[model samples]
Target chain A: MIQRLLLLLFLIVFAVSETADAAVKTIVLDGSTTVGPVAKSFAIYFTKKYGVRVTVSESGSGNGAKSLINSSCTIATMSRAMKEAEIAAARKKGVNPVAHVIAFDGLAMVIHPANPVRSLSISQIRSIYQGTIRNWKEVGGANARIVVIQRESNSGTQESFKELVTGKRMRITGNSETQSSNGAVKNRVSTTLSSIGFLSLGFVDSSVKVIAVNGVVPNEKTVKNGAYKVTRPLYLYTNGQPSGLVKQFIDLPNTPEGKGMITELGLVSR
Target chain B: MNIGTRKILDRSFTAVGIGSIVVMALALMIVVVPIVYNGIGAVFFTGTVEHRKMLHAEFKRGDSQNLDSEVASTDRYRAKVYDMLTGFEAELETMAPEKKTEYTAKYAQVQSALRALLGPLPGDPEPMLTRFKYGQTRWEKAEEKLHDLLYESKWDNSNSSVMSKEFFVSRAISFEGTSLARLFPYVKENLENMLHPEFTFYWGFITDSSVDSHFFGGIWPEIQGTFFLAIGAMLFAFPLGVVAAVYFTEYAKPGFLNSMLRSANSTLAGVPSIVFGMFGLAFFINTMKVSESKSVIAGALTLAIMILPTIIRAAEEAILAVPKTYREASLSLGSSKWNTIATVILPAALPGILTGGVISLGRAAGETAPIIFTAAVSVGSAIGLADVFSSPTPALSWNIYNLASEHEAAAQLRHVQYGMVLALVTIVLLLNLSAIVLRARISKKLKC
Candidate 1:
């Protein structure tokens, strides 16, 4: 009887404390590293404005979609559209996920600043990466072996590159050097004299020269106007029409604050 | 020194050692604690549900807002929803308070219909306002309806299969189930999505099985390719390693030629693995026109050379460890020098030779840099394995490296890669342990 009374008192105190504190909302955002900065910025502003918490994680687009499918995150940020198979999988689970354009990104083909070549035609760029053109000399550059750098499979950047450059066809060169992230690819290209790699325009800077593909450089105008052919939409895919914190966070990325952040991050405004 | 002084010194030294272990353990905790603590803290953190509800309210706030699109669907949705809500409100004007329930239900249906219709608008603002006007009236009516149905709607809160089950259960959950019962928590997961995920293009190099255009399915062909290369290495190294060890330990005299051979063999062991790879490429692949400069045979031969020292050392130690008395006994029986050494010394050292072969095999399987220069790409399904005399093959270590470094997004599978490492380690461990166990069994049988 004494123990039971103590438990009752404790329960009462717990209920009182629970009622005293306001609830918090947590939204998990996961997907493309390309979309990560914008998502993170939105999450930060949303959290501050509404007192709701948001978590952001960056994997590649494929993994991000998996995170949504696997129920690991509230939203999947992708630089590509959801494939038919993914939509079917979600529908199978009775989840009719909705997508909203978060922003746009121009995939950048970059090289060391020291590289002599300033521009490459789409055909030339494809040939370099596809191993058909092994040496830079063929493309009006010094006679040096072009060290081709590539991204790992899970990267959204790789998907965009394949879609835009290869038209979803052609194999990558056998001897290509692989880097894990945009920074790593940039670093490798910067340090290696004859190395070339692709990155999202969001990651472009003075360290590496963003080469013009067929005289088209990666810019907000280029990407937005579709003049930069190697561009993909950054997307926020939700399990369903977001209801609750997720919806609020999703809306936040399309707001003035979110757009400004995307612009600052070098991502093209949607 | 007295015995007690010696004992005190030993005790203090032991205490120092124990203290150092504790200090190291504490340092390890410093590294691990924050990770574990944050994981626990995030899981147990509360106050999420109310925030979730509030966010939902935000979505509905502008639900009655205008959509900018002039599309046919938006126009139809806007007009249909406005008509239903306007008709409901007009109907409500004539309704008595006793008939408020019917008016409310009709009002809710109008809002749901409006929300459903305008949801697809691409942020167009004109039709959205009309949709919103209908939604607000619908929202109030729906809230009332929700309050009435709240208890009945989520009555079966314990159904694990329902994602909304958590919404109905009391927030303060205390019971912890055994491992078997823990399966209920994951019931809502779309496991098929995990089992059949849409992979991107990076997986194409490994396995192209996704039926999708992205990946090539699996690295199974690469794995098989690596196996072929490692097997080729073993084939060339095993017999040669054993023969050299047999000659050195069993038959070679303690003279100039023997010592010269021994010194040269020992010196060969000092050559770097990469040097061997280069040599193999130069001598075998390039000069011989053995398919290409980066073929499996060249890689295998290069690895065989790299592992030669290991094989030789193991075989030599095994053959040398065989007692001279056994050779003498066989000689006393008038057996030929070759026969006596073969029949007596070789049989006794079989276990040791196998131990050496296992070590050599492990090194061949795991070496990456050597194969990188000598064989095909670090991880390629296009294996040069068909013509054993010419083709190049990739290796497992190369597979891990390529998957980790070059395969976009394969870096995200750190756990899977780590698990693969664990598997590789287990293979080596089992092989070594099996050799030890075999030696022990053989010795026991010989003793009996």
Candidate 2:
């Protein structure tokens, strides 16, 4: 009985590996959670139109870079451009990393809607995050201890926020609570009376009031016109220039359908 | 000390024991009741016409004819809304540029809120996202969207002594002179006609693959992935664990090596789950080349290792608990030692061994950390059995975290998250229940 069971297990494993070897036209995308929705929407539309299977994984921007370098995924959807070290690593692995700007996202500084402070200069925002300004009064709000919220380090949104608002070398205060995603940060800022956080502009809604940075609100026009200093371009990276199905997918953002999905999800069309 | 004092102490000890049990039960109720309540809402809720329309369009599970009629009825009421919007736009076109700019911003907010409530406005190009393809599917959400349409939520920071308070200002009041002012009251009165909410039981929440990051459809992929991972872990871990237990209990001598092995087992049990996740990624994927990257086989192997110490410990205890008399009698009757151990000792320990297996199975199914680096993907379809070695699939535990904390629409998809939790709990409970029943039957047979 034991021998038969062992034989059966081996057979099953062998059969599965055999079937997996069968070539199917599939495009695999791995990367930033911020870019996941856009990638997924494009995959759905792409599959329907071209009859090819598309799968996406949201591991993180750093891991997406790793996947692309390892040649595990066809496209790496990143909210931030690849770092120098990552590009060097890809080159060492005989992979030529090329980036395609798919869409633009603005990081809106958000607070509880009731907070009287309507805007903050980039310097004031930097001071608040750096733990120098611990109270709302320092930023012209009521006398309450300000609760700082930030995203986990792995998040592409967090990286972009760091580069845009806080200096790259500066550290966020330890007192800040780390949320895992944009939705979580928005949820925290909306519910907490004296909390502040940044979110992708698409996630800004009625629940959280977005405070202007440098006296300019993050909107489609401001982001497009370069008035919104906090905006960053979302990207899809491939090894060298993409070809065939991957090329079609990389070109999705320029298509009307892709642009519509981007706007629908509350991102700026590039 | 007297006899009376002894009796009093005994009574207090009993009371303390019962009190602790009561507290534990209460704690379990506090955690489980809310999950059950909101989880039920995922299936049984007041669904609107849009819900039926979505079901027809996405899954082809509803009556198209009935859905068409529902659409026609809702559209009749919706036409007035469209007309009012057109009238307001026409009214804006003829106004001064300054006035147009003022109304345009506020008017834009109203238009978007209305779109959120009733879906894309008539004559707009079709929305590509499944979430935008339909309006509010649940009547409760519809009412919330309607409130957003009617009122602008504002914060009252008048009291400097406290945090700001939220207050609503009527959008109609803001638009008093415009045709859009009439749209608010009209929508308020005709909401029931526009939505046509009916009590619906959505069994498909369990059976259908999610559409567009769970904005619509079901959680079939997550449920199947969890089953595959848990059962695969058990299949790999059970036999090895049982054999190791037999060696420790029946054959191993009490020596330095045996004690060291025992300590190693305990140490393995105490390792944090996340450490196991990191090890799995490094050892299985990096060193062993397990399917090139994260896959179900790698995840199962990691979980099997995580649960192995527990299974071995439990099986050892179960073997030790079997009475010595049966083995002695079999040996005295001229049966070989191996025969006596297999027929007499093993049969007697099977029930207790199964109890341990069941508990470990539940742990394997519910654990999130070990699989994060090995097997779980945040989003994927139900992969075939053949693809388990190569594909990473969505499991209930990981997706629950993703949907609750990471999904872009986390706030809006609370029901999906709750439903996923309930499904996972049910799956684990059913597994334990079957094992319990099997153990009971086996014990009864042994007694006879």
Candidate 3:
């Protein structure tokens, strides 16, 4: 009986191993919390269509670059372009950094649904971030302290905001609260009445009011036409040219099904 | 059994007991030593002049005269480094366009590294973020920045079978023939003079509010929030737990109903902490509309329910542990049964009950999951006492998870995370220690 049981266990192990070997094609993408939702949706779609597994990790863009240079991931999804130093580092490791534009995203300035302010000029936003304008009343809103919320320092969204809205030389006030993700910023703004925060356009929902930037509200058309001021392109970086599952996954943005998925996720399709 | 076999069994039993204790001690040390060491770094470290300057500028606590003198001395050494950068910029202007572009990018890296190490360079625009307004605040971080200034870190991935290895190339080598070559060595050598390092006891790490997403400043908000949540849980749970215990021990007779209630209590205790959080969300926040959203009162009630079983169990055991003679003595002295239970029985079991209460307090404070959907937030200042009814706040247990896992700059703020863990562990351990002491005192007083 013991010998028959041993034989049965061996057969089961061999079958499992054979199936695992057959299922070797997998894609790994990591980085950029801003682009995480799109990456996740593509992974789900690709997996469902092609029966290939795809894994995505939402660290910031810097870590994604690091993962690519380290050759740990097949693709690195970033909301921002790779920095020169990061590119050089990847080249040094014999990894040629290539960019694939997946979608366009606008940085939506979000406030509580109860907030009365509809539009804020670029200069007014800068002044509020710079701590010069402390109260909502100072910017045509309610009489409450403007509780500024920002993304953490290493966030790709944070970097883009620094480049576009707040000048690189300007500092966000020390008093402003910092959240980690676009989702977190949305949550904070939606719940807190006297708060203002920024999130990726994909995360914009009815729970929070999206402030018009410089008299233009960010939508798919405005962001795509470059009329929205705080817009950035999302990217998936592959080490050299992607082939097989990686190519198929990255090419999803250009396909009708892929565009539908991207649009469904509230991102501007390429 | 033979005498010899019996002796061997006894010896083996003793060995097993000693071995287990040694293993436990080793395990505790492995976990605690790193926490204590890194936690100490949060408050006590070789702080640079920039640290003093930050304190002076932000909190207005440091001696201005002393700080001014140190800044002046550091600036004297920093002047040469700035001069080298200026020289390199001029040299870049004279080079060919391609050379200028290459050098400019490389030069930008060097300048940012220097800025990170020693704050703003001369002729640089004033920085907007409070982070860039000061240089490396700690000496160890200064060394790390100095290394960055000297070398460009790159990965080597030659073999497909193995992981890539990281190696640093000297930045001086890259700027071999350029004027920028002089900048690396000069900055590397004069770093100490440029950032006067001195040991600092920054007690404010426990008291002051954080700045710039905890890249600077302290964790007082998280600590205070943990206190509020734990205490609030106790305020609701302790009385209810003891009342149920009294009912079970003194009034209720053992039967099917009693057994069913006990089984339900145990079943509630067996439920997962995340389930408790979900229940809190559904029953309190969603269904009952507890302050519209996540609030301290909602969290406290959730935690109260979560810990209620443990508290009831502990109170029952303590009440049972009280000598029956005490009750008899009270009754003989003409006191009614209720009076005996109120004054005599309760006072006798007070320490044991307190011991359980203290443990539950620590458990509530250390818990993260139950409060995640109830009261805890990733980033919020300490709320006023009145705000506990309606507002959410950052608690130590939840923020530790947030800072470690979810913070964008999680890698850069290891000290803060360790400090938080240490703070929580200390709070729980201190509560337990006080309970142990109280029990000892109670035992001694009873003996007398």
Per-candidate local distance difference test = 0.60, 0.87, 0.81
- Model 2: reference contacts kept, as a fraction: 0.40
| Candidate 2 ranges beyond 4 A from true positions | A1-26, A47-53, A70-72, B157-163, B333-337
RMSD of 1: 24.0
Best-first order by lDDT: 2, 3, 1
- CA deviation > 4 Å runs, candidate 3: A1-270, B157-164, B332-334
- Per-residue CA lDDT of candidate 3, range B1-448, in tens? 9999999999999999999999999999999999999998899999999999999987898889988998889888988888888888888889999988998898988988888898888777665345667999999999998998899866454442332345789999999998779888888777889888999999999987676547788888788778778878988999999999999999999999999999998898789999999898778876787654467898999999999999998999999999999998899999998999999888788878878987998899999999876787554444556566666667899878767655544556789899999999998998788778777887677678
| Candidate 3 lDDT over residue span A126-209, tens digit each | 999999999987877767799999988768888889889998788899989998777678767767878999988887765678
Per TM-score, the best of the predicted structures is 2
State the local distance difference test value for candidate 1.
0.60
Chain A: TM-score in each model: 0.88, 0.89, 0.91
Q: What is the C-alpha RMSD of each candidate to the true structure, in Å?
A: 24.0, 3.4, 23.1
lDDT of 3: 0.81
TM-score of 3: 0.65
- Model 3 DockQ reads 0.02
Off by more than 4 A, model 1: A1-270, B8-218, B378-387, B412-416
Tens digit of lDDT per residue, candidate 2, span A197-216?
Answer: 99888777777899989899
Highest-lDDT candidate: 2
